[model samples]
Target: MDPIKKIAYNCRQATYLIEKQQISSITLKEKIELKIHLMGCSICKLFQQQSMLINKMASKHFADQHKHISLDTQFKEDLQQKINDRLHKN
Candidate 1:
């Protein structure tokens, strides 16, 4: 296989890299491969976006670990509704 082809990641690998990237630094080769893969793969790109958003939300929500906080009731209800809808759909 060509070197470039060998470096190209499948969707599963790309997603793993996407998640790994959030928690730690990937090697330069992996970064390059992931960047190239994301450029060509819209699905993986979307996954990366969603993962980043989730991480940002979680970080923000948990930033004050010692402080008391509560999830908004409206947000909880909305999330529950969405989950119920998806479960019924399947």
Candidate 2:
């Protein structure tokens, strides 16, 4: 495979790992490749910035709300069942 394409792919994987909080699982070489790609790819850089912003906002919102929220066992079970049904349907 072409080196540039490989680097782009690694950048994408790095972005996903970052989102999943799994960046520590990536190899040093992959981290370097992603940094190099982000340096030159404006679109990917924007994506990374937006993703980080979203995660920060979501974490803050959840932290504020979780203290006041309580879900019953039945509700949790029903929600999980619905999610599983939808996934299986798809």
User: Against the true structure, whose lDDT is highest?
Assistant: 1
lDDT of 1 by residue, 1-90 (tens): 776665464878889988888888999988999888887888888888898999888887788674777899999999999999999999
Off by over 4 Å in 1: 1-9, 60-90
Q: What TM-score would you give candidate 1 relative to the actual structure?
A: 0.57
Q: Weakest 10 consecutive residues, lDDT, candidate 2?
A: 17-26
Q: Give the alpha carbon lDDT tens digit for every residue of 1-90 in model 2.
A: 898777765666757756654334676776677777777778778888898888789889888977977899999999999999999999
Q: Candidate 2, overall lDDT? A: 0.75
Which pairs, if any, clash in model 2? none
Off by over 4 Å in 2: 9-11, 20-25, 66-90
The deviation in Å at residue 34 for candidate 2 is 0.3
For all candidates, the clash counts are 0, 0
lDDT of model number 1: 0.85
Report how far residue 11 has shifted in candidate 2, in Å: 5.6
Q: What lDDT is reached at residue 17 by model 2?
A: 54
